[model samples]
Target chain A: MKAFETYHPIVLFAYFASVIGLSMFYMHPVYLLITCIGAITLNLLLNRKSFISGLKFFLPMFFIAAIINPLISHDGEIILFYIDYNPITLEAIVYGFAMSIMICSVIFWFGCYNVVMTSDKFLYLFGKVSPALALVISLTLRLVPRFKHQITVISHAQKTIGMDISAGNPWQRVKSGIRIISILITWALENAIETADSMKARGYGLKNRSTFSLFVFEKRDGFLLGIILTLLFINILGSYFGVTTYYFYPTFTELTVTPISIGLYISYASLLVIPIVIEIREAIKWRSLKYNM
Target chain B: MQAQSTARADIYSRKRLIFSSIIIFVVIPIIMLIGVTIFNDRKYNLISMIIVLLACVPFFVSFERRKPQAREILTIAVMSAISVAGRAAFIWIPAFKPVTAITAITGFAFGAEAGFLTGATSAIASNIFFGQGPWTPFQMFTWGILGFIAGLLGQKGWMKSKIALIIYGVFAGIMYSFCMDIWTVISYDGLFSWKRYLIAMSTAIPFTIVYVISNVVFLLVLAKPIGEKLERIKVKYGMLNN
Candidate 1:
């Protein structure tokens, strides 16, 4: 699918603001779950193809987040099981689940951002800060699939020579795998050095690095930014007033879902939705532009 | 036949360099680092740091080559970073609680180099919030080795099976504890006593079980999907040799 379609910068900005806003304020499992669902739904609708493509990266992350978070955090109540007298509490489980949802949601949002923001948008946002660093970030995003491709080719070639990593004893297999990584690492570093040389040759990071952006701040962008600012204000106020507060000491206090809390949650959830809204507006604008042409 | 033979030889030579570099740089140094930290009474904190710094030598040397191109290098670095960060972020999630498992998955999906980099990078970077200490290198080496081994297992297809992944997780957990025990011995100036070792191992046992279980669950859930994605990436990028 197309990586970047025209959307108001405010929409993207607001979306990010909300995500950061929610993550900072809330600690409830329910709130995290709802936010995650909202993120997945928005991602699927706005960029269905990229969402699927991102699963390669996201699926493993989901499991990793879901499994390993609870073990380290052993401070919860309602012990589920005891191993060697160490209580595995339900509090830990709930807390872990909440954490996994938060992690996965953030990742999903980032993936969505990667598609929508594009290199051009990133250039627009951070070009002034450091062009060299921005270029590196952009180039890296474009490079993930490329690296994956190389590993496959190398593995296949190795396999033909009876070095198939998958067809070995466990120890031998581990050794073979290390062999592949060494090759890849060597290849990657070599590529980086060459790139550094090329950049130097081209005067990259010279006295002044010039940049251009295809984005122009429009009326919609302003409106979107205004909404985002309001949301940010609300989030800040909520946090300041302790609207999203919870306690895990003495005994676990279930988060009170007050009207203010609900409002905070809704506003934060709306942040993720902003991107989809921007995408829809852009799609309509493109259609109208096409008709005029 | 001659042309094919030449192409095959080129591939073979490339493989040889890759294998040698891994042995000399990644594997050997890791063993030595563990050995020095465990067996010697010397201040290994500085030496461990040097070993980590030295590890970058191969990366710097290899990156000098022209074949993989700028885009490919950036891609590898970013993905490696993402995988590392992703695994580390699991710690922030309170429910899943499987540190050992996550470590293994990082190793499995990325391979030893990526695994090592991820482990070391996570330990170093996470210290920004978690606070840094003498334990950083040891943690790096422990997790890095876990990831390295995971990658090795993935390459062998052992990571694909449930039982194998579980076994690997247990092995990784035990190995990590053993390695850390050695570090404690060096750092604390404890007698090379079985009681100290047992105490260290016992303290880590609960976490190890959690680690093993987590590793198993992670492998069961993500190994196949990540593998497929890696394959797709290979094809899309023309990484496969014709």
Candidate 2:
């Protein structure tokens, strides 16, 4: 298990929510750099393989976003060049880069989020607010695999009967595909009736019924939550006061440095780096323990 | 005793009425206000997301209030799961997912609310595999609304016609593409710009065409069989009556 993921679901959730929300809003170069680095670092620490693979998609998206803005929007000054009688401005390019980085960074943060906040945790959170919907989501999650397995079974049966999906022309293939899905749907809906009956037999909807979960709010979790909230509030305060706001249209905002701004930057960076710090500390601790053993 | 029970039920429904009204009328605008004022830069994506989430709140609240039976809930679960897992069956084809067709079928058989739930829940469930991102809520709202509209039309008995199915398929395609492009334009430009939006839409014409074709094909092919099966379940089990 990841060390950072061991925090209470609420703590983890609040941490990601604030980080992602802040990443979206704060476009100051310093803040964006901090978030981008923080997102990439946490993603690398948590799930490197997927992160690297995801970049294959993210990179092209980034360039397209960066390029498209200047092509369409000609609001900025410092025209770099002309394209089909349109002048490309430096400000738009910078703005585009900023937007792409912010977008990619938010996506990376979500990548970390998906790794840490597993479905069970998510369902637990929602279960608090609406148990029925959460139960529905849980059931759906369970049913997806079963349905997929059943599709394979149905397709194989069809194949034995010589209606194979892969062994036909495009039109024939699509027909076989639809036939397979149609059979699967009938089977699933029918089987679900029995599943529902079993659930009802177990008194599934009894009033005052309680939910079971293994998660507990520990002291460490509370401590981390407190720290996260404090930092988040400081950053929000910074944004509210216009300390973390930057502009790229018309002209660039002079990159300002001040005691308050530096303080805000530190807080933002620290907030983003919290999980990375936790992961590194846990790894070092584990290594030493293994060596001692 | 019967009179007292009736009175209690009246009060219960009244409370639900007020609750849903508050969520729809009061809370949704407040969320939009916050999104616009507080998160002002390129905040359309964020605002639309909150609105989408708020839009689904009333549905869930009412569904919970009804105290849905296991079979009803399981039925929705089954539909949503089928839609998500159905993506795998078409893995050979690119972007020709049956999610919308299946969602609309759920709505047509069940009701508007069930349709919305299946659409929204399947969006989240599918993203659980595809990896959740900023677009999840928009996709949820678009598909859910598609289902909601299908339910309304289905209730009118219009969805039975071949022409109606084709038109709805075309509409769902355009709706999905146009709605997603709103996010695309906003995220790229950090705000809404007509010029940028038009360019984005024009560029996405091919994708939109694919969406329209695929949706039309799936709905034309799958709607009848799935709708029949769902109707059978409802009739045989005597479920989802409310």
Candidate 3:
């Protein structure tokens, strides 16, 4: 089994949560790029199906996110050239490149999150803190799949009534579309009410209503989680001394290398790839097992 | 006597909204604009977004503190859920989203606070399906601001006509693009640039137009039916009377 995927839900949740939280909170380009590369690589490896599909929309967005920076953010020194007296600087382009990389990586990581943290995992993590919030998230997740199904059913019913949107004028087409929406709204609300009623009848919201869950916290999970926490601790401590800090605006800072900083970087890199290493180990075992069989 | 008391309460809440709206919509952005300009720092941008969200959320609670919260909460949640679902449902209409119109209508029917939460919730909840990024905060801010404004205009009877509502929708679409454009620029350059902002604005004109057109279309279609039903709920349940 893939050790990362099969870890205790809490470990996986903590791993993803810490990764996303840290990535967003940091503005350091070097650290961010390292994490970005790690995130993208892991995402593509673990969630290839969604990676390919999302690339269709996400690919263009990545370029747009990067290029738009140099266009609108005119900060930094080291002028590359002048576009009518307003200089287009190397710094801005580099900042754009880094920011875009960070953005794409965060998005890719989120996609990986969706693949890894199913509704059950999220509910398991958050159910006790606030059941209402958990319910809303789970309900919203369910809504997408059912919504697609209902649309086809509604469209077919409309076709039978000879009010086909495809055959109509622009105004009529919009009217028909609105009519379909109106119908869906009524049905959806009624459905929501029924769900609320059913939930209430089941003794939901009772303080003593205990949950049944199959998730178990194993020893291996605890060991991995300990390692993850240690890496995070060192990284945060190192950040105060500006380990990954690289200034771009006004002027670019000369890159520095030191032993402690190297240690910090190595820890951070290992933290990012812990799951990947686990994944590779599992794949190699599978290959060896297949040959033996 | 009953009518006069209700009128007085209405006046008080409207006054509170105007004050809070100024803080959320005007004061904070100015602070961010000046903070970044003077400090010449990128860290401030990140902190400012947090400040923007934290500062506005308390005001939302203040507006609803004395009101019946259950109905308001349920309504906001349901409407946000609807808007999020709608965003995912209509994938063919690129750049056009019913989420903004639905958020605007929620603000019109409920108060600005309700509108804000609905919009914010719509953004976060939809991103569950659409995928989240650094842009999540920006999306929440823009949509919440749109709802907040719609509520203010509704309170002032400015949204009286269908035409006015449609105009608001169109303006909101442009505002969304502009705000998102600001985010893009800041995210790219690590700071804002007026010249580059203008160029980015021009390039985004086509997308903005599509957004405006979609807002108009969705509002025209959904406002009457949804707004009326919500109005009926407000009266029937006598909910959110504060």
Which candidate leads the pack in TM-score?
Answer: 2
Roughly what TM-score does model 3 have, to 2 decimal places?
0.80
The prediction achieving the highest lDDT against the true structure is 2
Write the residue-wise lDDT of candidate 2 on A147-254 in tens digits: 878878898899999999889799999889888878888898999999999999989988787778999999999999999999999987887777877888888989
Candidate 3: CAPRI quality band? acceptable
Q: Report the Cα lDDT for residue B85, model 2.
A: 86
| Every model's TM-score | 0.43, 0.94, 0.80
lDDT of 1 by residue, B87-192 (tens): 4446665323344454455456555554554454444434322333345556766766677677677767666777786688668766766776665433322124
**Candidate 2 all-Cα RMSD:** 2.7
Q: Give the poorly placed runs of model 1, Cα more than 4 Å off.
A: A1-5, A8-14, A17-21, A49-88, A135-210, A248-250, A255-257, A279-293, B1-242
- Arranged by TM-score with the best first, the candidates are 2, 3, 1
What DockQ do the predictions score, one after another?
A: 0.05, 0.72, 0.24
Backbone atom clashes (below 3 Å) for every candidate: 26, 0, 1
Q: What CAPRI grade goes to candidate 2?
A: medium
Clashing pairs in 2: none
Candidate 3 residue-wise lDDT, A1-293, digit = tens: 54577887888888886777566546566678678888878887888787888789877887876776665556787878777778888888887777777667767777777777765876778665545445555666666567667867897899899767787799888778777877776666556555655666787555587878889888898998998888887876676556666777777877677788778778878888988899889989999999999
Chain B TM-score (each prediction, in order): 0.65, 0.88, 0.82
For all predictions, the C-alpha RMSD in Å is 16.0, 2.7, 5.0
